[model samples]
Target: MTKSRIRAAKPDTQPHFDYFYDKPGSLPGTLNIGVDAQPPVIVLIDYNEADATRQTLATPEECLPYLDTESVSWVDVQGLGSEDILQRLGQVFNLHPLVLEDIVNVPQRPKVEDDYEDHLVMIARMVIPKESGGFHSEQVSFILGKHYLLTVQEEPEHDCFEQVRQRIRYNKGSVRKLGADYLAYTLIDSIIDGFFPVLEAYGEQMEDLEDEVITKPTRQTLNKIYRVRRELLNLRRAIWPQRDAIAMLIRDDNDSLISDRVQVYLRDCYDHAVQILDMVETYRELTSGLMDVYLSAVSNKMNEIMKLLTVVSSIFIPLTFIAGVYGMNFNTEKSPWNMPELNWYWGYPLCLAAMAATAAGLIYFFWRRGWFENFSDVQDRTSRKRG
Candidate 1:
């Protein structure tokens, strides 16, 4: 099995900037985007209660006319490789300088800010599906205006907004009746709920590790437990700040951009965030206990090894001394005192009998004192029973 490697990460090694930085206090609406980003793909979804029109546009300027229209316009930009296109996108959307900078930055902390413009900027994170049971997450920024919502994703392929698109296209939900704020809420809620299945998978893994660590801990087992712990820490870091961001959205009395109804829904999203936090915390605690149990298990195995060595030495040390004494020749023919036993007819049998008695007595002593029973129990539990 391929397990994630256990490596230590220093605070210094943590990311200073999630993405390449633009100069501080750069002109408002200036685009200092990444060089390696893919060319932006714009998906325009214009919708109202009676009708909806979805189109793919060639340039950011093409979506400009609908921004001031009566219907709700959602301009979704995925991928950010071309600086020229991104800079134009900032102009077309009339985004604040800081808002544009936040969108281009790949991994900004999830946040919501209102800078006294016609927009409410929300920095939400999205986690993509992992093929190998691991996760990769990216940042998605939402700029909500009076009649339009502009969304920009870090990468082209990582998207979780398909459900919201379907809701609008198929008119499956109340999305058509709501404004851009509701659309923002729907997308944000989807992003928050995305963490659940990932967290559930982690919970199951930790439960499995709990069994694996205690029953048959090895060096490899230690690595796996630590890997799980490290990943949980990452998950905690992701979910915790997100919870605070959502809380801020609910608690901010100044940002009246989100209506009371949407704020109520944001409360539900907060609950989900709380649930995720609880699971991450619980898993962390379990992982810590597994570490302790692994240490004790390793120590116990070492002790058993020492005990076996002691038992072997105790049984053989005296026997070896007796054999050594007999093997010595002290001039037996000239000294009767030393040669009396050696000359006896049954001397060999008597000496063998004495060794046998000595071995039996030691064995009985160990058995009676429960040392053997303890060893047997350890073997039975570790070998015969399923951990």
Candidate 2:
């Protein structure tokens, strides 16, 4: 059974998703796709206000018939490592040479570009649910033409476009009435929304770390806080560039594909991107402050310990010296002063009283100077249970 499960388990090793490339300075449109990809599977959804048709396309050429029709076509290609299939898809869509290059670049920076063709190429990043419920990011290249959107996702298994697909299948929204740009907006909006739950989880994790850092900080707490800060930094890096890209989509004058109505929707998506960026920035600042607080609390704890040691030494060092002085053996028999005190009946009691009085006086002095209060304050805060 163990062997069977091991064989069935998903591989943890990440394979390289290299960009389809040519030797340096080679001409564009050179296809260097991977041999390991399954034959490209194209799912085409064509919709207009009156009717819609969805079909599993056998080849890239099959999409040709739908592209020229009066409907908005969305052709989603899951994997792009296949060279011959990608080349044919490029031709069937009549994609520009640079456009194909942009699409095949596995991890292009999120951007929007216009080349005076009847299209706009956008590189967007999509983060989807991982098998472990955490998320991983992938680049999605979009070729938004006059009437169709050709979206290529870097990975097959993790995607949040299923809802958009479902909406297309069920005609749940005004998707049928809008153009391909609107459809692109829907998918991008979904991808942006997908980031929220992940961030909410991070926020809660940071809050928990805050409590841990304050109450009983350990080396592990420091490590964990630092890790959270690092992760937040990564998140900030991801979302910051995305915010500018989405803002360009909403504000830039790309007259070819995105419509005015669609730009409004894009504005909403941009708002979300901005909100995500804001949260990331806020979290980053909080994490930085948490580090400071953690260090200060640790230092304060050390200071309290040092104060206690000082107090103990201050109170006992002189007392120990006094005891040592009295413990000395004098020639009492030879000297009348030394022998007279020893012969007194109350000498031992008087010495004991003097020691007690000295201890009491020193303690009273400490209490009057508020040293004891400072010590007790540290003890109380450290010991008190905070809800």
Which candidate number maximizes TM-score? 1
What's the C-alpha lDDT at position 281 in model 2? 85
Alpha-carbon runs more than 4 Å astray in model 1: 1-36, 252-255, 327-387
Cα lDDT, all candidates = 0.79, 0.76
- Compared with the true structure, what per-residue lDDT tens digits does model 2 show for residues 56-173? 8878888887777789999988887676778888888777776776676555567877764777777877775455534577778888888899988777676888888788878888
Give the alpha carbon lDDT tens digit for every residue of 1-387 in model 1.
111122235542223234334455555545545556788899999999899999999999998799888899999988877877888888887776667767876666778787656777788778765767757777888888888998888886877788888899899888999888889889988988888877878877887877887788889888878777777777777778889888877875635578888888889999999998998899889889999999999999999999899989987998788889688766767877776877779988998898889789988997998866766788889886775
Best by lDDT: 1
CA lDDT for candidate 1: 0.79
What TM-score goes with each of the models?
Answer: 0.79, 0.74
- State in Å the error of residue 257, model 1: 1.8
